[model samples]
Target chain A: MGELLRPEEWTALRLSLLVATTATAASLVPGIAVAYLLARGRFWGKALLDTLVHLPLILPPVVTGYLLLIWLGRRGPVGSFLADQFGIVLSFRWTGAALACAIMGFPLLVRAIRLSIEAVDGKLEEAAGTLGASRAWVFAAVTLPLILPGIIAGMILSFAKAMGEFGATITFVSNIPGETQTLPSAIYTFTQVPGGEAGAMRLTIVSVLVSMAALVASELLARGIARRLAA
Target chain B: MKEGLTVDLDHRQGSFRLQAAFDAPPGVTALFGRSGSGKTTLANIVAGLVRPDRGRVSVGGTLLIDTNSGVALPRHRRRIGYVFQEARLFPHLSVRQNLLFGRWFAPRAEAGAEFGSILDLLGLGQLLARRPAGLSGGEKQRVAIGRALLAKPRLLLMDEPLASLDEARKAEILPFLERLRDDTRVPIVYVSHSLPEVVRLADTVVVLDEGRVTAAGAAGEILSRLDLFALSGPREAGAVLAARVLRHDPAFGLTTLGTPAGEIHVPQTTVAVGSTLRVQVHARDVMVSLTRPDRVSALNILAGTVAEIGNTLAGESSLTVRLDCSGAPLLARLTRKSVAELGLSVGMPIFAVVKSVAFETSHRPPAVREG
Candidate 1:
């Protein structure tokens, strides 16, 4: 496998792994919180919150990427605030690509988790309440364990989405070799140049392998959780 | 009213209205009613799962809810344990973990029973390592009960915990419940629609109809009320008597129970002598005769005056007759033809004959205590 790939292909493979892991990990807590809120909370503007969380899935990937660039660019309000306060910059960086992937993957993660949360029995929470468990404890002791499979499924889906992300990463962070360049961006770069087909094929094979591995891992993780819960 | 659970509440949702006021004594107080009678709703209100628009709820002496003062204790802070109809055990946790789930929240000082003893009492020793999904219906309910009991709740509310089980399953859990009732001092508010369950388990029965509490009193008094049958179905019409186990006749496989009405004999029971038990004789099983019949196969006979007579209830052809048997109330159900043939009416002298096999001896120890 090592003898078949050039250094640049290897770099893109490593960068894609890093970006997908970071995106999946970074969106986990917020994804779960938003999913729970959407599934159980009855506050005002619930529908609006739901719509916003799901917007990335409905909108075209380029549109989502462009929107992120406009809001998170160095001169944008949020970008300017972060750069001035923390001396941090995201534009044209690997972190910016990861950010773009995370944003694009958020909807799938939240949807999977939200559906599972909704499927949970509310009576168990009530029973826990009567048994002296506070709402937080009830969620931790009962709700969390019951929804573990969903959370794992969501994370894997988001990771795969992040791995395959092209339009969003290119539009938000632009293709830059060894910096903002990811697997998809590098593959696209290879396709545009003369005599780059071999490199693109090698990188594409790596992408397919990584995605399959993720899918297998997800299947095992979900089955393990179900077995533990059923035990 | 001095102690126990007192709930007087009014709640309205859409078109349904629940306005119930009842003072339930400790021990086991059953919320008895047919389906949609609001008994479960009342139990939920007491458990703090449902907040009433107007009312106050107090268990023992603790003020759980007072809408008048805008004071309401949250469900967890109220220290109330609720065993739902479906058990609702944590499927992801082992039975032991489920049992210990509530102990994490209750203060150490409030943890009353030893965990081992609770497991023993509920017969859950062999199931400690198992999960909820693997448990039978009866086992799940027992685990649910153990989970609640381990919580050290100030009050235990059971909302027809056995309603989902078949008869065999229900019978399997009843003995454990009886042990819990007799051994623990925790006040239990049992919600059930089955009359036999109410009679066997509840020391005090609160009858609900529609959304109103139609009757509330000692189980014996309420079960013997002839008029209440109009709401509690005529077939369920019966009398509960506090009886003392006299002795067991091993040779005949029978046990003798002494009640205020008279000495009654039943099939052999394991209950020790001198232990008090509640005996339920269904009204339909009681035969009424104008004159004392000689050479009758029935073993028990009580002479009493017909205190009241009601017309056929719930379209049943049988007329319910309330009798005062030496200060004890007894209900007798007779067909309209038999009532007319005997020319029976209020204040008429009647002999209520009961077969020994017809009575159900509720083995629950009469450990009546205030909540």
Candidate 2:
């Protein structure tokens, strides 16, 4: 494993890990909030919100990346406002890659979490409220713990999706050697050259191993949560 | 008007409409009804979980809801503890955490021996560390009760806390409930479809039928009303009497109870002397006779005057006769044939025979003064 990976391959692998981690961590809170809202909120425009969240999954990956670029580009309306207000830029940067990955993986994250939140017994939350817990307290103390498995599942799904993201990441934040290039982008770059089969094969193997490790870790976490809930 | 509960509410859910208003004295006030009879809905309104379309609910002078003033308290702010039928304990938390979940939100001033006494009273001291998944139905309910009590609620609402348990589990929890009502002095509004449970626990009984209050009074008076027997199935017709333990006869394995009417001997009970016990004698288990019969195996024979005679309803084979045994109320279910043969009528003297060991007893702990 050590000898076959060149320095550039190592960079891609490390970059992939960093981008996936950032994407997963950044989306965690918003995903949970959206999931809970979708699961429990009874309001107008709920269906529209649901459709918007799931649009990335139904649209082509390139189309999603293009949409993100149109809205979040340096000269774009949102992009210029964000850059002027917060001095933050996303276009052609590793953060853009993470953003691309996050948008691409959001549907899976929210879907898993929403299902789990829906599965939680609302009656238990009512019981908590009657016990003198306010609405926020009920959510934190009762609903959060009950939906931990869903959160874990959502995080893992988003992480795996972010790691494997290629089309959206390349379109939104083009592949840069040590910056925006994730594992799939790096493998695609290697496959384009004549003598790059071996490198591509090695990176492909690393990608598979990382994805497997993520899935196994998620399984362990979900199982642990289930055991605790059952206990 | 005094220290009690007053509820006047009107609500509509789909096709069914509920309009009820009553004042319950401080004690265990039972909301008695069958399924879809709006008993649970009434309990939820009292707890501030369900809002009525128009009404005012006040417990011990604290206004929970007054639609006239547009004042409605949220459930958490109501400070009324509710024990649900399913217990509804948090599956993710241990029993200890579940019990303390309410304490964290309860006002500190209301906190005192409520926590320790509830833990002790419900016998939840041992299973604190166990998760709710590991608890039996009865144990979970006990924990649920403890959790509610620790909230230091002024009024406790129990929505059929034992309806989900089997007979054995219910038997296991009933005594704890009796002790809770007697010891805590927290006015409890218990919702139950089972007449036996109502008779066993409630000091005041409010009978509901089709989303209306058909009867409301003391348990003894409500249970003795033969007119309400048609509402609650005839099998549930019975009389509840307040009696004190007279003596425990070790020789014949009998315990004598002294009611206002007469002395009743039953299979020996472990209750201590001089403790007040509510005894429920089902009307069906009682036999009516004109003259005092000799050589009868039944241990209870009370001389009484027929207070009221209810005619047989359509398609009914039996008639209900309300008897006033001295000062205590007794109910006897006699067949139409027997009623005619014995010539039973209002104000006529009669003898009611009850089989020993047929009475259900609810033992109350000696009342403790509340601050």
Candidate 3:
């Protein structure tokens, strides 16, 4: 299998896994927090926050990538500060691919979690409060556990989306083999060159298999959680 | 009242207004009312789940909320345990874990209610390893109760905990509740609409009508008021008597009760001899006789003088007659036509014929004998 495809293809697959895992991990807490706010918070600008969270889903991926580039580019406000103060570079790198993927997949992550939070009975939280749980304690003990399946599903969706991310990632960080070139970018690169049909087809098969595995894992995790809750 | 709970609050939500003030004398004060009368709202105010627009609430002399002074404790800090109508158990938690959830949050100074004894009390010994979803309705309520009690709360508030259960399930949990009241020292505020629940459980009764407390006093005194039931519902108004079990006539499946008035024969009860049972004699079930009528199917009869004949209550065709049999107070709901035909006056002699089966359900140990 290692000899069948070039090491560059293997590098792309590994980079894709790293970018997707990093994106899912980095955004998980913030995703859950935003979802909780959307589901339960009644503060001012709630609608605006909700819309902001969902903007990446509604906007074109290229447009979102362009906006991220403008805001996080070397000469941009946040980018210059990070470059000068922390000496960390994101432009035209694998980390840039992860950032683009995270932003694009965030909306799906938040939506699933938000729906689960909304489905939770407020009465149980109230009951927990009466049992002497503080607000934070109640959320940690009751709300968090009850929304585990939703969080898992959201993470899987984000991971899968990050694994296959193309337009946003390519726009933000150009496809560089072994760097920013993820599974989709590798497949796209292979299809563009001559006699690259076999390579493209091989990468496409791996992508499909990866997505199927993710879907199976999500189903199994959700069912296990549901069974535990029911038991 | 003793070292119990006191609440005086006024709150208005849209068109509804709640003006309630009552001293709950410790052992299971039942907040009695119809669905819309704000019984749950009042209970919520006490538990600090709902902030009263203006009022003071204190338990065991500790002021939980005093809107006038701007002294308010959050529900969690108030050390209150509320058992909701629904069990509200954590679906993800095992029965043992759910019971221990409150134990985790209990104050450091608070002594934990021993888990073993509480599990034993609620009959949850076999259920510790099981999850809440696997429990029956009655078993869930029992676990809910254990969860609340394990908090070692200063005050326990039950908001119609049995309301969501069927009659059989309600019956199953009621004995555990009675045992909870009898064995536990936690002061309880029990909110319920069912008359039998109040009669069987409450020491103090607070009657609510349209968001206002209409009457508040000892359970026996408040519950016996014919006028009080006219507003809540007249179908349940009656005399609440404390009668001791003299002996059981097992051959006929009957038990004889020795009341302050006379010997009363009731249908079989499982209570042992000498236990003081609360007997709720429904006013409608008591037939009045001017003379000693013989061969009546009703097995219990007590001769007494008419204490007071209430005027015809509004929207009801019947007048309530109060019978004073020695020191015991019995109520009889007679129509105006019967009042006139029997020539029943405040001082007239009468025979109160009580249907024996009425006592079948009336023989539970209510908290307060005087109430």
Candidate 4:
């Protein structure tokens, strides 16, 4: 398997895994908070915020990538401020690929978690309150545990989406061969050049296998949480 | 200790308005009302779960809510335990964990209550490791009660804790509640619409009708009022009496209670001598006899004068007979025909005969007895 793929193909595979894992892990906390807010909060401008979170799913990936590039690219307003203030550069870096994937996968993550949070019985939270638990403790002990299955599902969905991401990764980070080339981008690169069919096929099979593995892991995690909660 | 709970509340949910006030001093204060009568809403106000638009609530001396001073404490901070209609035990935690969940938040200074004793009191020793899903309705309520007590709350609010149970299950839980009321110092505000439950459990009755406090006083006096039955509804109308186990007759297997009315013989109680029992006599179960009939099997007979008479919308008849014995008020419901046959009128002397089986002895201990 190692001999079948070139060094650059292997590097892209390794980089893609790193980027997707980083993206999923980094966005988990904020994803849960946003999901909870959407599911439970009643406030002005909530619909607008929800629509904004869902924009990436409906807008063309290239358009989202362009927006990211303009807003988060170095020398752009937010990008220049971040670069100067925090020495962070998200243009043409592997981190840029992670940022693109996180933004693109966020809607799916929030949606799964939001549905689970909404499904939780509010009466249970009130009971927790009466049991002397503050609102924060109630969320930590009751709401979080009850919605854990959804969180796992959301993380897996985001990871799978990140692994297959192509348009946003390429448009935002320019698909550098060894730096920012994710699996789909690498496969796209292999298909574009002459006599690259074998590499493209190999990367495509790897993508399918990775997605299947994530789906199975998600199911197992969900089942384990359900059993623990039931017991 | 001067144990008391006072709540004067006024609130509105959309178009529905709730304006109620009642004072319950210790014991089991039963908030009696029909469904949607704001019984639960009032309990929630005490628990600090629902903030009243205007009024003050204090349990034992701690002010939980005082809208005038803008001192409305949050539910957790108030240290008032609430048992919901459905036992909302945390699904993720084991039974023991759910019971101790509140302990983690209770102030360390107030955490002297022993968990072992609480579990023993509620008969929940064997259920420590099991999750709530594995428990029966009765067991769940016991665990809920234990959880609330372990929090060392100054007040406990139970909103129809047995409303979800069947008859057998309710019977299963009532004994534990009796034990809790007897053993614990925690003041409880019990909410229910079941007449038997109010009779068996409550020492103070706060009757609410359509979000207003219709009657509130000693359970014996307030529940026996015929006016409350007309105002609150028929199903929840009954009288509660404080009685002591006078003697246990082995031959008839009956326990004679020394109540205000007379020596009432009830089905044998397992309680010891000198222990007080709360007995509920439903208005419908009481009969008015013009004279003490001979060859009667009924053991409880008290001579009383007719206090009041009223009828429900369904044409069902009810009569409140205030007995001269011990100055206690006893309610006897007679048919409209019986009312005429006995020629019962206010100040007319009559015999109120209650069957031995009709008196339900609620076994709550005297320590938590509300005046």
Candidate 5:
């Protein structure tokens, strides 16, 4: 394992882990909120909101990256406002790569979480309300604990998707050596060069193992939560 | 006048419109109605789970909802506990934890009831460590009741708490509820469509028909009124009586109860002497006689004044007679031919003869309370 992973490959693998972890953690709260709204909220424009959330999954990765560039670029409205007010920048930096990865993985995360939230019984929430819990307390106590498995699954899915993201990250943030080149981008670079097959294969194996571990962990977590909630 | 509950509500969902009004005192007030008659909806409005389109609800002088003033407290702040038809216990929590969920959310100043006593009262001590999934239907409802009681609610709303249980499970939970009503000072607003359940539990009956309040009075008087039953449906018509156990005959294995009019003998009850028992007498179970026949096997024979006479339906031979036995009201269904032959009319005296075997004991004494 040590010999197959060249210095650049090792750096790519570490960077991929850091970027994926950061993206997944940052998107978790909003992902859950959006997913719950899609699953349960009853409003006039609910269907429209649902379609908008799923737009990323249907569009080509490069197209989504270009849209992100226009919207979150340095001179874009949100980007300039955030940069000026909070000194936060997300253009052509490692943070920009993380943002691209998060956007790319968001649809999958929300889909999984929304399905789980839909499965939770709304009657239980009403029961909680009648038991003297405020709406916020009911959500925190009953709804959150009941849908924990979905939240964990959503996180793992986002992490896996972020780890493998390539087209969007390269287009939006550019493939910088120690900054934005994630595992998939680094593997693409290695395959394009001569005598880089062995390194590419090693990184490929690493990606497969990481994804498999995440799936198994999610299965176990979902099962544990299911057993706890089995009535 | 003692402060009680007064509700006048109007709500519309889609095309369904519900408008109802009633008043109940400090006792077990039953909101009795059939399915789709807005019973659960009314209960939800009382618990603050549903906001009525227009209404005014006040319990013991505390305004809960007033559309005119735009004052509506949320469910949690209403301090009214609700027990749903299905026991909605927290599946992830143990029985003990589920019971404590409401207590954790309740303000510390309002938690006056002792936890140990509640456990003992519900007979849930042995199941404390078990998860909700491991419990039987009866046990789940008991835990639900304990959870609501621990929250220190001023008024409890039970929406057919026994509706999901089988006969045996219903039997298991009925006694616990009786104990809850008798022991706690908190008034209960129980919602049920079952006549037997309302007869056994309620002190005041609020009969609803198609989202309208049809009858509201003491349980015995309301249950005996055949007109209310005819308006609501005959399947739910029955009479409820309040009686005290007079004596237990060891030799014959019979217990005699002293009701308002006379003594009633039945198979020996497990309850001791002097305990009040609510007995339900189905209108169909009664037979009338103008003269007292000798050597009859029927155990309950009481003289009563004919209160009212009403025909069942067109071309039906039977008539429903409302009888006033001393102060208690009883109902007897007799043939119209017999009623005419006997010259029965309002204020005429007659005998209501009931067979002892037909009287089914509605509830056992609360398991935790011994007379």
Candidate 6:
């Protein structure tokens, strides 16, 4: 493993994994809540909320990143408030890159989970409720188990998107080596100079291996859950 | 202890409106109606799934809902078990897991101490490890029933649990349902469009039609009244006799049933001897005579006194006459001309001749009798 890539390349690879995992884990609960609301809730402003959730998907990634920077930058409104109140920072840091990746992947996560929630039979939830399960318990037991496959699919999709999230991440947090620089940033840096083809190719191969492993893991998990759920 | 149910509710969805009120005093009180007659809506209201516009629902005098004072309880806290038309067993759970899903919520004092007996009662002992997807329709319904029973509910609401099954599957599950009704001793509100199911399972019957309650009374009395049958089944007005199988004549393929009316024989049934069941005698199949016809070809003759005469509308030739055969109610559809020729009066003694094969009787399986 040491001979395959230098120290900088390894840091970029590890940083990319860290960013993607954080983004995926951070968005899971809110993503599911929004997806269920869109699928089953009847309320005002639902259409606007839906469109806003999908804005990252349809909008250019740079614009999403720019908007995020405008609102969450050090001098920006939320950024300044968070910095003063909590002594935390996100701009130009790895955390900002993770935020950008999460925003970029959120639409995929919400869409996948929403589709599964729609496919689930609401009557089953009602059955659990009548069987003495509270509303929260019903969701945890019946709704969560039934939608396990969809949640896994969403996670895989979001992870893939986060892994390749170049435009938003780069715009929000510039290519700072050993700081915000992830695999994509490192590969771009390698390709910008002469005699850098080998390094760039190596990192690209690493990216492919990471994504393929995630895909295969998702497949196995989905099949195992399906088998357990069926006879 | 058998806790009775009382409900008086009014609700409307779109253009459909429902107004119903009835009392269910233990055993199975069937909501007998046709497909769109609002039986399911009433059940949903009682179970807290549907909120009625105005109503009062109480189980064993404990108020569950009272729109007058906003005393409605949520569905999860109602402690009422429901077996839907389709067995909505959780696909992700094993049979044992499904059975215990609601058992956790029951109070500690009632948390299914009879769990092993219930599994035996539903024949689910061997299926504990299996999931629901591969089970047959009958097996799935049995599991559903067992799951609801394990909840230790004060009352059970079954909305045609056998409606989705085929005839053979219905026959397969009917005996188990009978056993559940008997052994569990839970007051059940059974909803169905099938008349035979009502006669076989219902102790008290509440008849609904076009979103209105036409009548509610003891099952035998409500069923014997021709006017009540006209609400849903106009032509099936008959008597429901509580009979027990005495013996079987295997040589002639016949079974002897001892009813309060007299000894009656019918086509051989698979039900075991000494099993008690309701036997339905159709009005169209009866031929009444003033004196005993010695040379009649009919195999059964019941001695009775004409108790009541149905109203004969102008220009209508046929009317119904009810007979009290030793306290057993029997209905006979006779022509106005026949009544006038024989001078049939309320006290006149008559003989009701019915062919043995015309008895539309219920055939319970053998397993339901002794166990």
lDDT of 4 at A46: 99
Clashing pairs in 3: B220-B371
The predicted structure with the larger lDDT, 3 or 4, is: 3
Question: Between which residue pairs do clashes occur in model 2?
Answer: none
**TM-score of the second chain for every model:** 0.95, 0.95, 0.93, 0.90, 0.94, 0.89
* TM-score for chain A in each prediction: 0.97, 0.97, 0.97, 0.97, 0.93, 0.98
Q: What is the per-residue lDDT of model 1 for residues B293-351, given as tens digits with 9 covering 90 to 100?
A: 88999988888899988776476677878888888988888898888888988888889
True-vs-predicted CA distance for residue B198, candidate 6, Å: 0.6
The list of candidate 6 runs beyond 4 A from truth reads B1-3, B111-113, B231-235, B244-257, B266-275, B308-320, B333-348, B360-363, B367-371
Identify the runs in model 2 with alpha carbons over 4 angstroms from their true place.
B292-297, B363-371
Runs of candidate 5 with Cα error greater than 4 angstroms are: A1-4, A42-51, A70-89, B231-237, B363-371
The residue ranges of model 1 lying beyond 4 angstroms of the native Cα positions read B313-317, B364-371
Please state the i-RMS of candidate 3.
0.7
Which pairs of residues collide in model 5?
none
Pairs with steric clashes in candidate 1: B26-B371
lDDT by residue for model 2 (A42-159), tens:
9999999999999999999999999888999999899999999999999899999999999889999999999988898889999999999999999999889888888899999999
**Which pairs of residues collide in model 6?**
none
Query: In the order shown, what is each candidate's alpha-carbon RMSD?
Result: 3.3, 3.3, 3.5, 3.7, 2.7, 2.9
What tens digits encode model 3's per-residue C-alpha lDDT throughout A30-83?
999999988888999999998998898889898988887888888889988999
**Candidate 6, residue A218: how far the Cα is off, in Å:** 1.4
Interface RMSD of each: 0.9, 0.7, 0.7, 0.9, 1.6, 0.8
| Residue A82, candidate 2: alpha-carbon lDDT | 96
Best-to-worst order by DockQ is: 3, 2, 6, 1, 4, 5
DockQ for every model comes to: 0.82, 0.84, 0.84, 0.79, 0.65, 0.83
